[model samples]
Target: MTMLNQMKKSLGLLLLCTVLESHADVLIDVTATMVDPACNIRSENSSSPLAIDFNIINSSELNKSAVVKDFSLYISDCNFSKSLAMVLNPKGGSTLSYNGKNILATSIDGLGIDFTEVTGGTIRALEMNKKQRIYPERVNATLYRMDLQAQLVSAVPIKQLELGEFTSTVTLSVTYN
Candidate 1:
């Protein structure tokens, strides 16, 4: 081959090699999104069961026992005035007594479950256990821990507010490892 042609080919090959070498270090951008379930409350005035639905996404990885510590329920009404009274029954073969006198808290604010009256609806560390006791012979039952049914008693009758809506706001928080 001619000297000039050979020189030209060499320069082109060297340029190609330089381009390939420069492209070796790649810059990539990555991102992801995490979604969690929405939790809320439900209730009724008459002597009926209060059904609560917990929206749990990626529940497979959840340790039910560990997560229960962070679980809580705050039943309150409008005007932010009154909270439905509740009682705590420890695990033992106890008698079934629904005396109006066995009320835990007067207003939702009086209930020391959470910190504050409005926002203090949290179930504290001490309140949590490996399992919850709902009734007699039903020890270690799952009824009280995750899903619970409580009878509501108001100190004064639940008078109808002009708002015309009987509502209970429940908030659930979950902390996992």
Candidate 2:
């Protein structure tokens, strides 16, 4: 309507934008309660260990195929009032060396664990860097299952084969919408 009014509105808009921008994405230190989960994962391991062992894989085996183990993250007794999502911590709980593809770093060089979500999609390093494997589902009246697969892989060209143990534990957390 008026030049002065228009200038004032623009200034207000600029101030609003600056304020919003400054307030964006503050630091977050996440802590999991574990005391109450919308649902509980059921597995045979009573000690709360989700692990797989590739017993003494040869160079050829590592080169040819990836050793894989199947595990399911079953959610029982879901009490989510709204939709929920399950995210696997990008670091997988423990920080171990990683191959180029973000697979678990092995004790010996040129070895890694090719992690994937058989039921969902390919596994990446994390949500921010790569696509984090997340399973989102509507609040259901029954149990929900997320099946995952991991493989022991070797680089195409074998440099040196060292005998050692490779292990990893991934931490998982939940968020609601």
Best by lDDT: 2
Cα lDDT of candidate 1 equals 0.29
User: Relative to the true structure, how large is the alpha-carbon lDDT of every model?
Assistant: 0.29, 0.57
- What tens-digit string does per-residue lDDT give for candidate 1 at 22-120? 845678999988633322223223223433322342323222222221222423221211112223432231222223222223123222121111123
TM-score of the candidate numbered 2?
0.54
lDDT of 2 by residue, 1-177 (tens): 599999999999999999888855779899865644555665535347665666776667766666678776666665555555555544533323445444454555666566566555545333212335345333356766666676766653565656666555555554453
Error of 1 at 58 (Å): 44
Q: What is the TM-score of each candidate against the true structure?
A: 0.24, 0.54
Residue runs of model 1 more than 4 Å from their true location after superposition: 1-5, 12-24, 29-165, 171-177
